[model samples]
Target chain A: MGITDETLKRRLDGFRKRMRDKEIDMALLVEPDNQYYVSGFRAISYSRPIICLVYLNSLQFILPELEKDHASQSARTDELYVYHEIACHRGKDTQFHRPLEHLLDRQPASSTIGVEVDTLPAALYCMLHERNFIVKDMGPDLMEMRMKKDQEEIHWIKQAGVLSDLALESSLHHVQPGISELELDSFGDKKLLEAASQQFPDQLIGFADWTCSGITRSFMPHLASSTRKLEKNDVVVHSRQVWVNHYRAENERTFLIGRPSNEQKYCLELAIEAQAQAMQVVKPGVCAKDIDLAAYHVFEKHGYGEHVQHRTGHGLGLTEHEEPYLRFDNELQLEEGMVYTIEPGIYVPGVGGFRHSDTVIVTNNGFESVTQYPRSLEDMIL
Target chain B: MGITDETLKRRLDGFRKRMRDKEIDMALLVEPDNQYYVSGFRAISYSRPIICLVYLNSLQFILPELEKDHASQSARTDELYVYHEIACHRGKDTQFHRPLEHLLDRQPASSTIGVEVDTLPAALYCMLHERNFIVKDMGPDLMEMRMKKDQEEIHWIKQAGVLSDLALESSLHHVQPGISELELDSFGDKKLLEAASQQFPDQLIGFADWTCSGITRSFMPHLASSTRKLEKNDVVVHSRQVWVNHYRAENERTFLIGRPSNEQKYCLELAIEAQAQAMQVVKPGVCAKDIDLAAYHVFEKHGYGEHVQHRTGHGLGLTEHEEPYLRFDNELQLEEGMVYTIEPGIYVPGVGGFRHSDTVIVTNNGFESVTQYPRSLEDMIL
Candidate 1:
């Protein structure tokens, strides 16, 4: 149903090996996704601060009292230190830092502590620094470990892809002039939930979507779905990410409403071709930059290179956007089991944005796209 | 419409005044909500580092190239330093830190900087520390400013509350034993989006929901809505947060399905009474703890105090949970225009969880409940 104990053990072992290599006595994980990767427990939000400390031989969780029971049932930890928020347990540990400090006291004064530098809050980092603990960044190590997908992770990602395809299909089916961007997104959301409920009972499923409709809105890369009604000749960039059991698969498409200009149709086809070119470059032993360049050349050859705003794609799994990004500057070699989104987008001020993203896993020789939604210009025009 | 330019100007002035009082020459905000509060712009995600710098005279934004157009349109910043990910802009700023370092280089070497210590990443903190800048926490100041909603904020929140009530009604109308928790949530989600699309044209509307059905699942709060089917005699805690233009209003309810036990009915009534007691204490000049204790007393009087795990309520706004928490240890006085969620619950092991949450804005004398979903036991029993 969730991450298996064996999987957690393997992850811990890999993390421990990296910790040893870095001479880190302990690793403090504050990132929710990183913590979930190691402890197999994730809270809805970290507004109260949930800290997962991974010692060489043991795992510890310092969490809010509300999550005490939930973490106990799910977390693969050796010790749990619950912090109370209510009045009844006022005298006891009421803040996460209290338990964290207590745990830090047990360690030798000179012990080097590892943390996800990019995610750990400055306040907590200062606490360790004040104690004279040698702090080191373990962010890259964790990202490297999580970059490659295991069989179990791939399985959930596949399920998410299937659900995302269903959602995209539903959204497209209901797309019409005068329907608001949010209303268009709602149709897919409803269908996805219904289908997921029927097929994957008892599994935790979540999704996020962004639909930027109209020339002005779609020209910008990121925006939430608003109540802006779709109009004739409007361009809409709809993106959806669905996750099953915490593994994510991103699926996005750019479509045109009635009477789209020839330029708009051409841009949509270019985006589709760019995505295909990027996906075709996905194979074991290929450089990540090669994938980005492959897609860039397509747009460059078409005289739309100056319009490209972002990188080709980003790694996908537990987080919305992880490391091993398919960027021109990233020289990381592609490997089997690594999953990425092959989305190459270009935004022209008057024409609008064009992009189609699909989640694909690098296979033994090439890549297997989990998201099989249609991407042709004919399929996209509504 | 978005935040008014005058409102952003006033917010900046207030923030600058706080900075002056604290002797902070410059303030760096990393938390998206805080950044948005000051700059009137927020990205979808911070996977790419988006730093907002606030000085006494001017505001600056350091963001990715992709967000340049988006920020230019939405942000009230005087300066923007765009960092590129693609190779074409390689000679220019290739990473966020490059621009960040350049910006810092312009600051006085011995200047003190205010930062949201709880939200700023350790990596950025270390960068500042290495350059010998004195860092101070401005998280409390930001929280204090955000705790009290302005008239414009209240307007959006009220709209969110109205939409939430409509969504809740739709979900309850479709509630059935055979429906999965995710399916239940979808009904509300669909209704909310559809209604929002019609009512608030071109405005950004978003929502999140958690449906914990059955005794075991309901007993533990904070779990996401899953593909678990509802059953007869089930206790379901359905929680929702709907936001309009980023101002949120939470509306939640605990309902009984098909013939709940007598104990379950009593617990639901007790929870409703506790919530009422807490709401009654929400007035200007009252301590925050008073609101919590008022609710705590109800459960304590019933000899079910031990069943309470979380605080009675939390401040509601852009973030899921913010400051001025209604906890026994928090003695901060409630002020007019402050918003809080009056959610008091008792999670009985076998009887299930009973809780109802409603967002309320503090008024001159008492409070105005924005979320007016029915809370009567008779209304809850299905």
Candidate 2:
């Protein structure tokens, strides 16, 4: 969807201010997510090298001619320049490298060009260097801009959360005796497709244990479902969610297939308490590490500190995993309009682990949990 | 699986000979497919930063430590060197910037290092260049070697093909009206997961023609199902086949949700015939373009030339889309042991498109269609 002209202006203005403060002359946005963030356009043809050169006064988009129409309609074009692909026969198309040359010809030399150096291909970088563009680090600055979610972004994420909740409900039905872990993933995946308001790229599916046991937790974001069948007291942890290009919503809950033992119940309670503790203190101005510490302290008080593995949470948006992670070392302060996860878990080697995770948007005073799936200890049952 | 010690030595010797002939001292393999070809390991971390440096006598596998074990298990120890997470991690054992420095420390100054410059990240390239390693283009030479599959690679591809055929067959029964496209994908995906010999990433599941009238041909190669309700004459096209790492055994066929018109029948017939004609000429000592021409001419003769879009086929193995493509421009010679697709399609913009793609391996004499799913027009009934 095209961003409103005012919104585009606002974003560009924001970036301009940040660039001026950092003394970066021009930011060359290459990463798809960053491009989408500043211009509100996702490239239709990514095969041919394409990028947006965003300057304070001028915005230029370079793309193959086949994709020019899509780019023009999607990107706010009143302030942008377009590159069209020539109608060349298939063989001749390989030698077509004039667009980049044309862009360089029009621009000034010796101007410091900020690039998403981390993602730009070596060939493209070489080509740019050959033309004498002074490439500098623009990745971190661009990341900072996208770290905060605006109202519209949060709205979409909340919508995505609703779909995730429905998908979890549908998938839970398939977890019966004899069902393989892989089958549960497929079942959950199918439910996601059925539940989504609309399909997104990558057919994104994140499947993990509902409860970590033995060597299962090592995989972290394991794509394969568990091989072990659900037993009477088997606890499983899983995250069911999707991201439509960066705007993401996920909900994770640990479940017991049947009856649970006292230890399992205790583990689940600790995890819930840990998550609750993070949630209680989640608000604008709080250091992200404080949330991790809050959750860590709760687990430690219960003599399960070592088992509180991983960060309390991580910022979630455009990508399923992003910056401002709620880890012990992170110094990012929680801000209004910031959305991230509050996932805290406890794992015991031979036994199992419990985790409660939800996407939460830091609000003016507190936080709004986007994931509405049932997380109460009473509701989590076979 | 570790390559047989003999096979590893033989491949290494072959690479050395090729490098010498090309006047290159060393070629760096970073593309996962190329890395898997040289070393028998395929990484589950598809987009993660990992680079494998292969020299005349030794191979250095540099990656995030989480992947060291996977890479080591895939390649031989005699030729392996590893750089782990310690060098890369910056804080909380999470953020990392060290392994990259470690990689640069090992690079020999003034040595000719061949890199797949097209895929290498710009930042990494700059870092390597700053360390004084001269980088050169190695993709063309490596791609030439991979155009033809070896005996063992062909064997695994055929095995993957058989499993894919079964997956398609079992999933056909689940296609019906009122079923969401995601449900169809899930059913087929479940079968694939159950029958998986090895995990393949981004296996094709072209359901509706999402490109044109949103029916068959448009949603191709790597599309997941959506919540779109299946209906009469939807012309569902699913190639939810498994890819065994770089080796793929993909089989795609269109289905008539209900009764299909004569136009639809002709489209499917023309596509199947085109694929047949292309298959007839498949063998060693032929150029890839000839195979493409065979199919192109047939469709042209049938007055459906304009309808046939995209390349006639593409090489398979290592990457789902590989070199030696069956396109008008491809002049690469077909050799025995080369494996690729011979898919020919006919797309009518507003109605639907039809394609019949099969994994074909160039035999010593002719060719063998690895995907043996029934392709008779009569067998395509819903």
Candidate 3:
């Protein structure tokens, strides 16, 4: 659980460089991603705010009293401040601002503190100003620093990829007729946990809510699960992606419930082929859109162009979805260690759709496919 | 899903009355909760920014092209506008400012727009002035408008409670040794999908990750699933609640894996009795902290006050953890129709912990308990 001191020092150097380029004294990270990136301390709370004070030389954390033990054990901080409600002894009405106020009181006076203006509340900004910290808004400078994945991140993502493949492998056996889509989804969830039980010890979102387009799957993303039970010749879709430390990896596959029709088989074949075609061009220095085009042209040649909804795929790393998406309009230049998904799907209303995607990492020469699931239509039968 | 015009008109009237008191016009709501509260659109793609352009007489929505169809279908708006990313394709990544800029351009010139300053980003605020709209920071005017739930909101929340209970009921049967905590948590997730299907699809921090106590359990409020095998004497805690359309129905239960020791039974009994005692005093005009003290006093009487760590609970209408917490410092007087959770726990470190909590609605006389799970320790069996 402890990151090497080298990793810590390198990130501080990166942040220091970014802050200097942006002409800021200190970067105040409020968003969960920035906090995790800088301090290596991730609170278990989903949406509860954690204020991370990062100066060039040192770092500090202010956490709720309940989470003090957690922060002390997890966060790489020079100092830790704990705040509690103290309501058990005091009968007077007090606002929930005491802990934050106490932190502000101790802040360096008139310091040019660069805040994540988007995440910091106006009230908190006012509170800081009242305490003599001149808050300056630092834009996406810190986020841009996180755009590229390092060695450890790439390793963790590779581990996540192995876990995703295991999930797909386990769930494939349960994709028979009479089983609900949710049951299939939960089955995949079970598989993901089984794979990561040792690595993460406690990992959630291993198998997230699965979205399927049984009959009307022509290019629509984010389909809600339906009560329509799997039947003979039903086209089934399942995605097993894990989100950890604000990073995400999504890999999807389409299957036949019992016996698929010729059209369904053709669609699945073309989709898989297109994704493979996209995978061939994912080398360092290639434009992200060209790889997207590599897949889009295949789908267009097969007359499924209009039906191919959604982008080819998205960058698969921190934040289930982030910058450098695989789309026609995206101008991002793919770099080594950049990980992304190349999913090409075709949906037709009331009929069904076919999708095949995998997470891939760009290598020096070409790329490495993180997903090892079978892509052939004949191989994906219940 | 369509609300009556009378109800809409009444809320609008109340909003106007509050606006007049604050001396602001054209309240601009960008946060999802406030947007849903005013415009009634539940967003799917959290990628696109959706804003509620509320004026004196009517409300309008500004959304990205991909969200137009879904947002238009659900949003209670008189007008809708869609912005693009330089092309006709949907969900294409452009700067998020493009759509936000377009919305400000369409607004009437020289009108005072009340911005939710706490939620609106500074970059977005800079964009507003560039588009000729005069922006004024409005404090808690919109929050005050949403604090009191209407009859319809109460109905939806109660339905959420029923669905949450069904999930807990289905999940309890799967609680046994050998199954990883993630699998146990997945049972609750599957049950939730079965109960409300689409209406209640979001995650309620329960299950999947925090099912078993190990290293993760030590990190209180763990949202991820643990790999720890449920042993004969282990205690499993579920802290996740159910959230439907942002309205929260908080509930938690601790289950005994197989046989329980005398201290374990004592912990469970104390937590339930304390929660019951707190629930007994909920009604109109009681300060929120008094209920917290009721639970605190019981734990103190049992000489387990130090172990009864976390705050009693908090207001649970929107966001699983919201404002007006049942803590020692809160002095907000409870009103009828206000719903919140009263979760009190006794943690014994590596020895495991016990908690019994439920969502309660303050009625005219006493209160209506929304969570119907059995509070008895004997009911939870392997």
Candidate 4:
């Protein structure tokens, strides 16, 4: 209910417009991100399969009976078909195919359908193909449409950035010589949730602000969390994610407990310089790879090129990671309202990691840094 | 390394045995749960895709470069393939398909391959079949093999149940007039995490204990949480999920803020009785649907059949919800070591809701309750 129905309607209309131009008659959206983007129906869909079928003039959200209450509560489009109920499908010995067919039968049956081939389950794809419908990949087009953020989406995403900053700040306040990474994580999350609740009383934002501490585990990027306690000269990575009205953003910083060694200070400042260089040129029409290159160039200039491991960053919105990715393989142009995380890290095996991640929004002539946090080497030294 | 390699090896042998019986030469596991079950490689795979290709003779874990470090550190299987490296695929382009082929090429070139058709992306599925490999659904076989819980899995799941109980208990202590639901949620999570940190300091489990409070919002079963204060005579349904080494379990209880009205007390006791009845019959060789019927029968006897919106409950393991769901259509028999949740909920329009969910495992003769939370109305009433 937080996101306006008008906004959701506009999104659906955008997809339908692309469908018509591509000569596609129907579209089936199965990815939870797409479902949430289109209809505001968000549910834990890791193992369970939920289907959202969209026709030229109608839409049906297919889910299990167990999920009905939640689905009905959140979904903007309310035409729901039960996965367990044969009566809902209204066909002989009904299964997924029957319900899908039943929904399609009421439509014009234009034969051409758009499916999320990139994310939809394989069995469902084969079933539809066997039923003889012309199928096309909706991934490219859907991604293209989703890259540019609307004002409503931007508002939610910016709020997520704010919450992430709150968590990062909380992490900084809690970091000490004897503190366990898990302890900081739980306390930081609680602080973020409390801050978010104070801001939006009616909503709850999802969070994953796990700590990656010490040298070895910190070197291994994407470490969820560890039980290792922070010690003097240890690098504590506080990578945080906060979801506001389903829009998510990433904000992180590397803290040096107590003090930094000469190498640690050099790596920390080098990472900040790399992040700044990437942020400086993040304007409309700039190549995504160029931002990544700028970060890599900093490490090379500093003679720490071997320590550089990942791309500068990737995009964020409804999901933590999305389009407009900053990588070497792709040459995609950044556009206004396109948001991405600009995290450039240098992780040395035995010396711990140094990095700071911030959500950045590409504006007309410059970039708007949504995540505002101190990144100087002196400021980050605990 | 959370679960022992010996356990992972046994699990691999189990899957390989199934593959041999089905004559599936190569199995491509893309589901995160399947990957974790086989190789102990756990990652947040809601959006990111990780591939685990199991050959007759060897196993290869394919992941993106960013994920390589953590994947290598935890995965028991040694063979690792980097998706970005052209050397790994040995072709012009290095995409997801090429590395998949690189692994498949090492095998005896069997025409038939097993893939998780139920969960694998549609485009990947079509591409494999188009490449002339007769792709068959491994979902059924994999599920059958996963239905019976191993000792390692059960141990982790039991720990999750314990954390849930701790969290629920913590929530009970904080529930009082003027206390907001979000605050209780944060406090409860902190308590659970603090306890976990002390026991398994190296691990930080994922959590999402959604709350449905008040009258109208509580009527909407999928309500995540609100900042609304827990006033006197309010109904609060706390549905929690705690993860232990990626194995998940649910332990939920509907609580009264101050005291329940006559109607509320009647409904609460009815739901508890329904849950108890379902739990009573959860023994080896018992039909799953009959267990669901036990709960539904109770609701019908109390003339609250229409108020009963959902099935008894679903299974829980790697994910919070999985297979062996207790529903009328399903005729699958319960077996020893198979774990599931037994939750029977009743929701009236204006009167609010009542339900208690417990993680239960089918035992040799009877049933074992992994979740040991108090279900009595007086005990839960603040």
Output the number of the TM-score-best candidate.
Answer: 1
Query: In terms of lDDT, which candidate is stronger, 1 or 2?
Result: 1
- For B1-382, candidate 4 gives per-residue lDDT tens digits of 2778788788788888888887888888888888877888877643446788887778887776657778878887768776642121224434456667665555554467889888888877876776677777788877877878888889888988899999989988888766667777888888987788778766657778778788876776566676666778898888888887778889889888766788888888998999989988889999988898888889888888878766688888886667788876678989999999998888897898888999998889989898998998788777
Interface RMSD for model 4 amounts to 3.8
lDDT by residue (tens digit), candidate 2, B176-268: 777665556566666776655134322311111121113532433233344556776777666644655345666787767678888778878
- Scored by DockQ, the top model is 1
- The docking quality of candidate 3, as DockQ, is 0.33
Estimate, for each residue in A1-382, the C-alpha lDDT of model 4 and write its tens digit.
Answer: 3668888888889889999998888788888888888877877654446788877777778776556777776787648876652112224322456667676665554388799888888877776777677898887887888889999888988888888888888878877777677778877788887787678777757877777888887787687665567788787778888888778888888888776778888888899999999898899989998898888888887778767766788888887788887876558988899999999888887788888999998988989988898888888888
Docking class of 2: acceptable
Rate residue B106 of model 4 by lDDT. 54
Count of backbone clashes, every candidate in sequence: 0, 23, 15, 1
By summed lDDT, the worst window of 10 consecutive residues in model 2 chain B runs over B204-213
DockQ-based ranking:
1, 4, 3, 2
Model 1 / residue B41 / CA error / Å? 0.7
Candidate 1: global Cα-lDDT? 0.93
The C-alpha TM-scores of every prediction are: 0.99, 0.81, 0.86, 0.95
Provide per-model DockQ scores.
0.86, 0.27, 0.33, 0.50
Q: After superposition, how far is residue B9 of candidate 4 from its true place, in Å?
A: 1.9
Give the winner by lDDT: 2 or 3.
3
* iRMSD for every model: 0.9, 6.9, 4.6, 3.8
